[model samples]
Target: MPTTSSARLAALTVAAVCSAASTVVLSAPAHAQSVRVHDIQGTTRISPYAGRQVADVTGIVTGVRSYGSSKGFWMQDPSPDADPATSEGVFVFTSSAPKAAVGDAVTVSGTVTEYVPGGTSSGNQSLTEITRPKVTVVSSGNPVPAAVTVDAASVPGRYAPDGDSAANGSVNGLPLRPDRYALDFYESLEGMNVRVADVRVVGATDPYTELWVTVKPDENRNRRGGTVYGSYAAQNTGRLQIQSLGRAADFPEANVGDTLAGATAGPLDYNQYGGYTLVARELGALESGGLHRETTRAQLRGELAVATYNVENLDPSDDTFAAHAEAIVRHLSSPDIVSLEEIQDNSGATDDGTVAADETVGRLIDAIVAAGGPRYDWRGVDPADKTDGGEPGGNIRQVFLFNPGRVSFTDRPGGDATTATGVTEVRGKAALTVSPGRVDPADPAWANSRKPLAGEFVFRGRTVVVVANHFNSKGGDQGLTSQYQPPARGSETQRHLQAKAVNTFVRQILDVQKNADVVVLGDINDFEFSTTTRILEGDGELWSAVKSLPRSERYSYVYQGNSQALDQILVSPSIRRGDGVEYDSVHLNAEFHDQISDHDPQVLRFRP
Candidate 1:
């Protein structure tokens, strides 16, 4: 979700201080010194003096956040303590525009508090801050503290230590080794000035004015200059989030593999979004990585073309219809059949009783024709009211659109919005008893999720089976930037079952017809290398078409510094072993800020 306008305003103040060269003197009452910022922010995650009132805490104003709930300025001690475990800088929460300017030496009196941005229930770590501050500026025009270098060599080789039980996620209560663990590295430099040089962009720049970069490119590196997210064990410690504090002008429009010419200098901050962020004021120029939005693949003669795309909650009210249609017609070469996900009901997100998506699909098909493409016919069962979970009342479900001139859908009897379709053998060939039917609709794995839409098509007198799916998303899972070490992926369990359900249904069809041209594709919500995909492709029953591409080019989605495959097109043995089968992930959306959706559409071309 995007940050609120008020929060962005607060971040802008911090960015202003980062770019500020001089500070002006202001008349204010002076107070006697008592404690240092290092003492307020101890080695531990929580503040030692939390809930206690402290008098005359002395430090220089480094940066200020003038909006949001915890609006305040960061203060740093000019003379630091000998202990390397403690941070010299601390945030003063004023909850409004601060009176102190950058580089001002001042004394502050306030109550030390530990603030969790998303509240206590979120399981996120808290930031130590001084609230309700009484500030008195004693001097101005003082030089700010120099930033510490944080390169690959400065970062620790390991991320976190293992624990015996699930409760103990990582080794805690240890001394801060900024050079050892990535979490400790960020914690030690919390609220302090830091610099990362010659970094490569691993994550695309987001609309929230932030991007992630990889400082240790030599370790766990991809050919595109990104840090590959291999699995739970090899968490990439080199990746770091870069935030301009909502400074739109300072933020660059960058994609993965892009490089920064010079060093990015800023203060280290811990937030709810991505654990540790470098709120930089001065970022180097962005250099191109020779990456471009890919064009449509050449259409093969006498081959059936199919595609899978997540249109990102398309409804009657969305104005992205024309752009999406253009992408399908021009960039996708107008595939013979297209599998789509997230097609909302007629009323979109309104909590009305409207459940039909006729208006939505009609508008999209009309736009495709208007874009000089083939007129398409669509088929899908409207999900039961309020059963398929996705934006409330959106009634998001999978739908198939086929060119009537080239392919015809074999619609049979006994399919409904709720009933599951059974596999049956007809004249010694496996087929769906009810074409355009739901796959295991009542399965527990599909509860509150979109069920797979199965459709049998006859193109050029050859039978083709396509299953459109949108599995449960990866929500409620611990992020890589979480304080917990080896973050838990609790969401993958449901997806595993969902994959198994689809695989079993496909096996039923392949059982009777050994050479069936079955294609299972859509947003599985897991990586190509994930356990979910592994379960779907068990024992080569289904082969992921994405693996046909090179390692660096097998991505259809970019998330958190990893260009991984979330949207995939997996084919059966017949399609995998057949000649002249080509696959390409048309990378027009995922790598750009003006993307219509978070996922890129994937196409599979083959002669059945």
Candidate 2:
């Protein structure tokens, strides 16, 4: 359940007071008529009796949430209605700690209100709840409603039906179609006790005591036991999030490919973060799948290994420097050059107008040497204070780390935070006007976002232009379970513009020297098949090397049970057609319970 704001809670309280006052003024006894729980939860996503007062709604308490600001209790009628479209259960909001307990038969009288989680603008479906409840204990120790089994067989293959075209593409008005759509199937069982048997974990447990599992064990199963999200049409309906109703510290820590042995029963809930979740009253025992981290083979002596890694907001104060250094040294096999994203300023997030990162980069270099790796030299242009869109005051930016023994950074001088770098001809060949410079930093597309960092490096006497990027994130996009069918992706507009800017820069370098050895890599923050990638690979100027791998092995990140790609490495035609190139999406993180970073690194080795 999503936390209701104090303002919204006050509004609800006022409305409840007004409704109670109306009941007192009406002389007719018909206003106090009783109704079933299914009547409150109508066939549609919203309640037909919303904002109206109902009396003597009876049910057995199946679950009680005694924690958090959204304190509530779920109750279900043992004798369900004949219609499958209507749910037999509903949640009663108590504002404070709920006094109801499991197995208690109670008669609740309250105003039926449709509360939208995350507010109405968020596109989330509304939860049918009874607010400002007046409860009457009818009996004690009554049997709780039998839990409904929700497995692959119970959920539909189709994700959702297209919304009614006349209603602005919204499915809120459409009747429930539980047999055809998975979203509707879950909606039909809202606030009801549900159970899943022997589910496989697809998302690792996080600090919030939440993890995701898939009921369909084989749905797009990869070799590492994660479900691959290939396309928008395939939303992977079997994936569901699980949270315990018990103590947060008691929740089992689980990784991808692990198993929840036996039945984990709970009430189906709709929350802000994850749509349909099981707040488990009976959590299953964790069984390890014996999954282990993978290490890539060392790069050949004659090959130049380039890698991209998003060290999730690395700062000098962080304790994971040793762990990250070990990952780069052992798991990634010490690449010749690495594009590190999210390196914070010296005073990490203090916001005192500090924009330098010499201390931060120096610490990482020292840690790498301590971990038995090469002594690396770095190059990067720090962004204006708070100009980059990240943790405010962190001043996150991209930096390149190259082993000085294997590669040399070409220093051209005169590159600053706001200065735009351009391509120029030097000795009848392509070269950067400013070696470590920003690409179109003043453009509106990069406003409040990390600008692309372009640098010149000489590997084995051959010049290579490397552009590191970290695009704007998907912050305002509607989620997969949005009430609006085929939810809108508003964040892609900015990313598409950002991609065009980089593509034009890449084209400029190729225009001067068509056979230039250019390596464009970093956390692109978009899928390999997205429009952003299409724009980056425009007119055969470049091609993403990640596509060379098998579709099941292309992902570098996992979210909500879907293994998908957000980090990529693209190369020019010269490098693509060069003497043999090897690409590996090293699986060192993103699938474990304890992760140093949320993103796995990608390494590409080729002869320049």
Q: How many clashes show up per model?
A: 0, 0
lDDT value, residue 555 of candidate 2: 90
| Deviating ranges (above 4 Å) for candidate 1 | 1-33, 163-167, 170-172, 217-226, 287-290
Instruction: List model 1 lDDT by residue over 1-608, tens digit each.
Output: 44443454344233212221211112232333367788877876655676667889988877766655547788888899888778988878776679898889999997776665444444455667777679999999898888778888888888865432555663334556765677777787888878898898888787777788888887666665666665666677888888764456567889877988798976787776677878775687899897666667756657899999999999999999999999999999999999999999999999897889999999999999999999999999999989889999999999999999889999997778888888888887778988889998999999899999999999887889999999999888876665455667888999999999999988988888988999999999998889999999987879999888876677787787777788899999999999898999898887775788889999999998
* Candidate 2: segments with Cα more than 4 A from true spot: 1-32
Give the lowest summed-lDDT range of ten residues in model 1. 16-25
Which residue pairs show collisions in model 1? none
Query: Listing every candidate in turn, what is its Cα RMSD in Å to the true structure after a full C-alpha superposition?
Result: 5.8, 4.0
lDDT of 1 at 378: 94
What digit string (tens of lDDT, one per residue) describes model 2 on residues 1-608?
A: 22222222232222223343322121222365589999888898877787678999999999998666567789999999898889998989887888888999999998787776666677777778888899887888998889999999999999998887897788877999999999999999999999999999999887677889999998888888889888888899999999878877788889999999999998998876778989899988999988899999898878999999999989889999999999999999889999999999998978889899999999999999999999999999989888989998899999999999999999989999999999999987899999899999999999899999999999888999999999999887888998889998898998999999999999999999999999999999889989999999999998999999998898989888888999999999999999979999998789987999999999999999
